[model samples]
Target: MAVFWIQPATFLAAYYHYFHGYGELIASHAADPSYEVALPGLCQPLRIRDFPSFLVDTTGGEVGKLVNDAFRELFEFMDEQGHGAKFLVNTFDELEPAALAAMRRYLDVFAIGPLVGSSAEARIHLFDHAGADKKRYMEWLGAQPDMSVVYVSFGSIWTYSKQQMEEIAQGLRQCGRPYLLVVRKDGRQEDVSSCLDDAVLKGQGMVVEWCDQPAVLAHPSVGCFVTHCGWNSTLEAMALGVPVVAAPSMFDQPTNAYLIEQCVAGVRGERNGNGVFAGAELARCVELVMGSGARAVEIREGVEALKGMAREAAVSGGRADRNLRSFVTDTTIH
Candidate 1:
């Protein structure tokens, strides 16, 4: 019947970033022979190495459960299928050939990349509205010099505990740079302001619940981006030619971080043991990236190169374009 299974990028990406914590546990289970009988095809019995990290976590509370469920639901579907279905992950062949290979037996699998690119483009257009929101981001950017401000955001889903938030503030305080932090207003205002309670951050830091991201990144003052390594955010940063401090909270973030830091030389942040980092570490990462003289220059130049490459990739005969075309063709073919 050819049931084509699609892996959600949001789900898979989350798995790539946070899977660090659960690897050992999953690996252990994979070593046990009993796993095959206990969970049947589910593979939880195998070990930590075989499973994504989310399944092994106990710390994120309900949010952790939600993450667990995301992966769970996908596997559950596979288990229910009589012969299973073809699986398609929302990724690029260049990015994750190994995982695609491993899952091939489960079903026919293909990787299509950066699906959120168009979505981000759509969001970018939304900034065209000339209203209070645009004015705030623009005016703020206007006041700063070129490449002077650091734009910091945690993507749409990452939420910090109160203590973590304060630590971030302290780190920003220590960095001694002009910054804008976009944090959701969920009773976390106190934690956000604790570091600035005195005049240490006067006229240096601004906190907004949300801001026009594309506008902010395009601003002359925005020298670097501190981000969660979400594909959309990463692409936007690259498109805007801003170096990224890739602090990936979970999922494909680690993979993304590897690309940015190792391949592109445009990122400067390390994932901690569990794929999560402390606020102090985040601060150090930011300082190294934002305050870096030579590294910053290299990053800016590298970003410019990527922008050129992105343009070529979009052209009719460009590598990216062809890859995209092949992606579509693969998805449609038998």
Candidate 2:
């Protein structure tokens, strides 16, 4: 039986870009994980590491098998359907033209998103189960000076290693700015808490179990976002014009980080010898995005420009709006 899975448009584009919109290339490149490739719109060449795990992982396991199966199934379905199958991707046309163009060569693909905007009202309840201290967090944010707070969250799914959490705690201490960090109530709650010294964070930082992420991103005090580079979070941050300090965890994260850097809107936090983001590296990334310098100014300006485009696309008569309406009309007719 064929299984199905969904992927972000940007990440899906990385697949198309690497395969050159052909399945044959995927079969041919099965041997070389180290080979370099480039997408039309991006400047930096990508290796297998920059793509999704299932695309590169040779480690045979049940998880790998399921993901690989789904990937193959997706391609087969697309190929079988040909131009008759319409793909309504949750990405705005202005955001990823190269990827969209690549897919449209064979499929009826529409770039109708960054769809978390008001028009689409994309919402997820994953964070709700965490019992976030919303009142305290919101009040704290309200009290902070404009553009002074650094908001950090790695989405709801991932739980960091104790060492990584310790490194993050240490980095935020050294970050030299007020930061609001979300430590989920998953198994690693104590791991993060144990690493964080209350003395260091006293009156300077706040670590809550959860917060309304969209609200935090939109807050005026939030200047820099330390994110896992999830697509939805990426869009939210971009739309609000908050500069990102990319600490990608998995899947589409690395690609989104690359996208952020390519757009001159952020810097990726460099990993240490252990392939973990060291405390110093985290501090450096935060400084690059939040510091008062030419580069920081440019990054902020870059994200602001993207913010305008994202809002424009969500509004009536915009590309996202038009494409969405067209899809609805076409589907209704069919």
Q: RMSD, each candidate, Å?
A: 7.2, 3.5
- TM-score winner among the candidates? 2
**Per-residue alpha-carbon lDDT of model 2 for 81-111, expressed as tens digits?**
6566787777777777766776666667767
Which regions of candidate 2 deviate over 4 angstroms? 1-8, 17-35, 39-45, 117-122, 127-130, 187-190
Of candidate 1, the 10-residue stretch with the lowest lDDT total is 36-45
Question: What's the lDDT for residue 152 in model 2?
Answer: 84
Best by lDDT: 2
lDDT of 1 at 89: 53
**Which tens-of-lDDT digit does each residue in 259-331 have in candidate 1?**
5764364664655565455667767766666665777677777888766655554456655456556546665
What is the lDDT of every predicted structure here?
0.58, 0.74
**Once superposed on the true structure, which residue ranges of model 1 sit more than 4 Å away at CA?**
1-26, 29-52, 55-112, 115-121, 124-132, 187-200, 266-280, 292-294, 315-333
Q: How many backbone clashes does candidate 1 have?
A: 21
